[model samples]
Structure formats: structure tokens, C-alpha cells
Target: MDKIKGIAHKYGNNINTDIITPGKYMELSIEEMAKHAMEGVDPEFYSKVKEGDILVAENNFGSGSSRETAPQALKQAGIAIIIAKSYARIFYRNAINIGLAALELKEAEEILDRDELEVDMQAGTIFNLTQGKTYRFTPLPDRLLTMLEAGGLVAQLEQS
Candidate 1:
């Protein structure tokens, strides 16, 4: 399993895929779309995120459209993991298909923006590895954790 660490970007309810990667930018290259990624929600999103950063948000993450490009943009923008209260069905699958980690947690909003978090994919736990220590998330399922360990669903299926 991979251990990922990053600064959190806390968002509230109903964060759709469109906000994740706007439809207008769909025709653009992945690299281009990544530059404008999440621009709708946070104007400084792309600039704020660095390589290996994580996105920690609230309920209904990946709602709306079923474009795989949404997760692709995040991956291209260097997001290794996304922790949220829940995920839309298609977004969750697409994320895993592309080797991005999508973890479900009940208290994701408790994590503040820029909060340093360490995500242990194998252990399925998120720890506020920062000094403030404000938030922590419950472990993911063992089955899902195993898939993450294998580097997402495709790889997991290949292995099997």
C-alpha cells in the first residue's frame, strides 16, 4: 500500500464532477484541463495543489456527470488521493480505474483546509498528522483497501 501525505482542501456538500472538471474544458487536453481544474469551486485550486497533494471534502463528492475525465484531470494535476464523506457511483469507479485512491469517510468535513493529513491506504485510516490534530477518518473496507493496494481496480482485476 502507498502512504500519501498532503494539504487538505475542505469543501461542502454536493461537489459534482462538473466542478471537478468543467464540461466547457472537456475538449482541452488533460494538461490544459488540469490547469483549470476545480477552478469553479476554488479559483486558486490548481496553484494550491502540488504534486502528491490530497483533496478532502464533504458529502456527495463526484456527483453529476459520469465523465472519466474528471478523475483524469485530478490525476493529471497531481492528486494522489481523495477523501470524502461519499462518492457518486461513476466517479468512484472511474477514479479507481485510473489508479487514484478514493476513500470514503463519514467525517470528512471535519478536516480543515491545509490540514496536513497522512493517508494509509493499507490501514485504511486518515490521521491528522499535523500539530493541530483536529480530524481523523474511519478506515475503509478491507476489500477496497486491497484494491487500493493493488494500485486500483484494473490492476486488482489483472492480478486476480
Candidate 2:
């Protein structure tokens, strides 16, 4: 995939799925549910974040429930990708299945809120333009890359 350039919305550890999209909004469509995303943590998250923005967080992002809606809500909310120190394994797969790229970088905490970033998902490279620095993470496997490039497993299967 091409490098994604965007402003980062940085956060701390343990950002669970519930905080991502509360269960109360489960009945709503992804579009409507996205408006409530991160409301529990940041009331202005949906408003302040623009399309193609990158979400940066510390360890255990998506630590709560295993609902697919959480990642769906994020994708609907215009998060191009997520960068975290670590992720709940299920959350990682769900994100990929939902077409949201979630990357792991131990130095994720160093990325500041609103900092400009350019990410090469396939190469696992992150460039913090605002800081004039670059960081790397383990690249995704080829099969996963294919799914992500096709915009999720469903799209990939359809293409086949």
C-alpha cells in the first residue's frame, strides 16, 4: 500500500473497545456509532479528528470486548490507521478484517497529539514529520498485507 500521511491523535494505554465505541451505541449504524467513538475518553474526538487521521496509543489498545463494531466505528470515524505499543490479539485481527490498519511500535508513546506522520504500512515505517524522526515496527505478513490492501477480508474474497 502507499504511504499514508496524516495528523496523529495520541492517547495512553489500555484503550479498550468500550471506550472506542460504547455498547450503548451498538444499535446505531456505523456512521452514527462513530460519532460516539472515544467519547468516554475524549468528548471531542470525532469532531476534532479529520478523515485520514492516524490514531496513536500506548499498550493494549482495544482491550475490552471483542465486538467487530469497535473497529468498524473507528474506520467510519475516518481513522486511516492505528499505531500502538501493543494490541489485544483479537483486536488486531478484527481491525484487519474491518480494513483498519493497526500497527505496533514500542515507541508509540513518543508520538504526540496532532503530530504529522507518514506511514508505510507494508514496510512498517513511521515518519514523525513534526519531530524530524522516523520509527519502524514489524511489518505485516504478505497475506495480511493483501487483505489490508484490498480493504479487508470481504473485499479480498470478493476480488478472488
Candidate 3:
């Protein structure tokens, strides 16, 4: 499993698809779309995030729409992972399908903003060493883990 390290952007519940990757910028190119990713919620998002950074949000993430572009935009923007309290079913599936690591944690709100996190996908653990904390999550199934490790469904299929 890949190890993800980054500063967190913590937000509360109901962070929907539109806030993640807005519809108005969907028609743009990957580089262009990345510039607008998360612009709805955080205007400085694109400028603030570095490659391999992670986004941490509360429950109902990726709600409001089933658009695949939501995850695509984040991936393009160089987000390595997203750990949330809960995710919309379609968005969760889409995120996994596209190689973006996402985990559901029960105590998501407990994590502070800008808290540096180290996520171990294989171990199903998030190490918040900044504050001497560790959060555990339900591990993804072996098959799903395989897909995520191989860079999502299409890459997994291609490998087969």
C-alpha cells in the first residue's frame, strides 16, 4: 500500500460534489480543472495544495451528484488521499475506481485543520503524529485494495 503524507483541509458534514469539483469547470482540461478543484469551498485550494497532499472532510462527502469528474479533478490536482467520516456511495466507488485513496473514519471531526497526517493504506491507519494521535479505519477488502494499489479499476483490468 502507498503511504500518504500531507496537511489536512478539515471541514464539516455535507461537503458535496459541487464543492469538491464544481460543474462549471468540468469542461476544462486536467491542468485547468485542477486549478479550480475545491474552489467552491476553499478559494486558495489549488494554490495551497502540493502534489500528494491529502484532503480531510467530514461526513457525506461527495454528495449531491454522482459525477465521476469529482474524483478525477482531485486526482488531477495531485491529491493522494481523502479520509472522511463517510462518503456518498457513488463518489466513494468512483474515487476507488480512479485510484484516489479514501477511507471512512468515525472520528473525523476530531482531527484539526492543517494537522499533518500520514496514512498507511495497507495498515488501515492514519497517523497524526503531529498531535501524537492515531486513528484507525476499516481496511478495504483485499480485492479492492488490489485495485487501489494498481491505480484503480482500469489499471487493474489492464494488468490482468
Candidate 4:
């Protein structure tokens, strides 16, 4: 039941895992892989992003390979959360496993780039501060929420 407020960066549909981290950078560490995040689609993404920023996408995000590095790159790049119209199943699971907050909101397309957003996971609401609108999304399941709160699967397992 935590809240995240940040500026949203919008992306289009079908943004796959290869575009997220790129295959070439797969061998690099998380910190290094982060530098190449979204380089395939948005070459300036790394340069423009800052800690606590939110990524908003249209649909089928993380559509390609099931590589976990994609989510890891985003996490390391300081993406606090990702809001999308839809997410690939594997990517969704990988994101939660790594403690990266992701929400599926059909209205996500309405959010514009650089729009300030407030996401309340507890209430399953996304408030667009810039647009003065509120969007409701299905809340993550309790178990998934717990995993994210504990800092992903590994951390949750360690705690038990």
C-alpha cells in the first residue's frame, strides 16, 4: 500500500524486451545494462530519465523474448513503475519478481509524455496531475503486492 509520484514518459505499443535492454548489452551488469535501456526505440531515453520516473506505454509491452534482464534494466534505470494498456505475461511476471511495479490500465494511452502522475497501489488509482484526470485499474493480487513490497521474490523468500 505505497504511493509513487513521478513524471511519466510515454511509449508506443508492442515495445519488446530487445528494445528495452538490447541483446548486445545482455552481458553487462545491471548498472551498465541500464545505460542502454530503450536505446533501440528511444535513443535518448537513458539521457533523459531520472530516478523515480514512471514509464507509460500503450500495449503489449515487453512483447519479445522472456529475458528477465529487460525488467532489471528498467529497475536499475530508476523506473519506479510502469503503467500500460497491456503487458506480456512473462514480462509482467518478471517485473514483479524483480520488484518493478507495473500496472495494467486501459486508459494509460491517455497519459501524455512528461505528465506528472501519482500512483496509489493501495487504492488502485492513477491520478494524472498534469491532465487533472483519475484512472482506475485493477489492483495487483495480495501475494504479488507482498512480493513487490519485500523487494521481489528473492527478498520475500529470504524473509520467510
Candidate 5:
């Protein structure tokens, strides 16, 4: 898990939680809701996405309610990581708590859809294989990295 390699699914700004998971589907199980993830913005999203794909986007990538399920849906839908210019504090925390790798790359808009990317979390770098370029992101804190490695906060607590 040192590096994450995947095809990118790029998005635009203001990608809210409601747009990501749709509030109506909130009562459903995480798995069931996952099948409808991002449906509000892209009706074919669930079908279009493949396991281990990376989600890239511009500013404010997770902006609505503090629903942890929003991030859970994406994770369940097989999004391996998220690269965005910025993120809502709540959504970012939720992603980390659930062991979903959500990184911030100021140059996220430079990445294209379906671009093959290799990410080094510890090194804070993204290599865009398709575009033949590299981007750097802010490194994660040591404690947060530890939580992610143990599979989110709950799992980390269990291990402790």
C-alpha cells in the first residue's frame, strides 16, 4: 500500500455530500447507497467507475452535510483515493476516519479523466502516467498516517 496506482475520474468544484451520496439514499446500507454514489452529478457514475479508480477534482470537493456516509459511499464504490484542490473539513476528516485516502493537490485540475496515476502518499507525490507529469501534495501528519494504515479510526482503536 506504499503507492496507489489507478485511473483517474476527474470532477469539478463544489462537489457536495448531497451530490455525492444523495440524501434520499442515506437510510440505505452503505453498500446499497454506494451503487448510487455521485448519481446527482453524474447519472452513470456508478456504472462508469471501476474498482481502484482515483477521484480527482477542483476546489471544495466535499461541501455539504457532515455525513460520514458520503465518503463511505465513495469508498464502497471502489474509489481508492481522492485528489482535490481543496476539501470541506468535515468530509476530509470523515475520509480519514474511514481509511479513504483523500489528498489535496493544488494542481488537481491538471489531471484528466482516465489518466493513469501513481501516488506516493508518504512522499506526497502524484505521477500522472498518461500526461507524463508529476504533482506534489501536502504530506499527511504522522498520527493521521498511522490511523489510515490501521484502516481508519475505529480499526486503529481496536488495534490499540
Candidate 6:
């Protein structure tokens, strides 16, 4: 796939799943749930987000419940990718399973809100267009990359 370019929406550390998508909205469908994504942290989040936007956050992102709704909410809201210092194991897996690219990078905190980023998933490099700098992170494994490229696990399975 081609490189991903989008505006960044930065968040602080320990941003859990509950903040990503509150439990009250758990019963909602993916499209409905998206309207509530990040509502706990930013009441205007959904309104401000554009398709192909990127989310950048500090460590321990997605630390709460393992509900897949968090990632699904983000994907449905048109989040192209998420970059964090670290992600809760289940959240990381869920993101990829649902075709929302998530990356871990020590320099995640360096990214600022509204900064334009160009991410090369294959090279695992993030170029900050606003700051004229670049950061690197480990690329996803082949299997996960394949799944993400195919638009998540279900789509990948159907292809095979």
C-alpha cells in the first residue's frame, strides 16, 4: 500500500479503552459507536476528526477492557492509524484484526496535535511534515501486515 499521510491528534499516557470508546456505548453498532470515540477525553473529538486522520498517544494506550469496540470505533471514524509508545496487548491485536494500523514508538510523545505525518507502514518510519523530522518504529510482522493490507482478519481469511 502507499504511504499514509494525515493530521495528528495527540493524547497523553495511559489512555485506556474506556476513553477510546466509553462503556455506555458498548451496545451501539460500529457506526454509532464511532460518534462516541474519544468522547471521554475530548468531547469534540468525533466532530473534529476527518477521514484518514492519525492518532498519536503516549505509553500504555488501550489499557482497559479487551472489548473490540475501541478499535472498531476508531476504524469506523476513519482513523487511518494510531501511534503510541506502547499499547495494551489485546488492544494492539484488536486494532490489526479490524484493519486499524497501530504502531509502537518511543518517540510517540514528540508528535504534536495538528502536525501532518507521513507514515510508511512497510518502512516503519514516520515523517513529520510540520517539523521536518522523522521517527522510526518496528514494522508489523508479515502475517499481521497481510491481514491489515487485506482489510482485517475476516477479509484476509476470505481471500485465502
Predicted candidate 4, C-alpha RMSD? 0.7
lDDT of 3 by residue, 1-160 (tens): 7677888878788889888778887788867988888887788988888788788888899998898888888888778888899999999999999988889999888889888999888888899967889999988899998998899999999999
Query: All candidates' TM-scores?
Result: 0.86, 0.98, 0.95, 0.98, 0.97, 0.97
Query: 1-160, model 1: which lDDT tens digit per residue?
Result: 6678888777888889889899999999999999988888898888888898888888889999999999989989988899888888999999887778888888786788888888776666677876445344566677877776787788889999
Clashing pairs in 5: none
Give a tens-digit lDDT track for model 5, residues 32-59. Answer: 9999999987888788888889999999
* Model 4 residue 72 CA deviation in Å: 0.5
Q: How many clashing residue pairs, candidate 1?
A: 0
Error of 6 at 94 (Å): 0.6
Give the better candidate number (1 or 3) by lDDT: 3
What are the per-residue Cα lDDT tens digits for candidate 2 across 12-122? 999999999898999999999999999998999999889999999999999879999999988898999999999998899999997899998999999999999999977
What local lDDT score does residue 37 receive in model 1, on the 0 to 100 scale?
A: 87
lDDT: worst 10-residue window of model 2: 119-128
lDDT of each: 0.83, 0.94, 0.87, 0.93, 0.92, 0.92
Predicted candidate 6 versus true structure: per-residue lDDT over 66-147, tens digit per residue: 9999999988888999999999999999999989899999998889999999999999899999999999999988888889
Name model 4 segments beyond 4 Å from true. none
Give the clash count for model 6. Answer: 0
Off by over 4 Å in 3: none
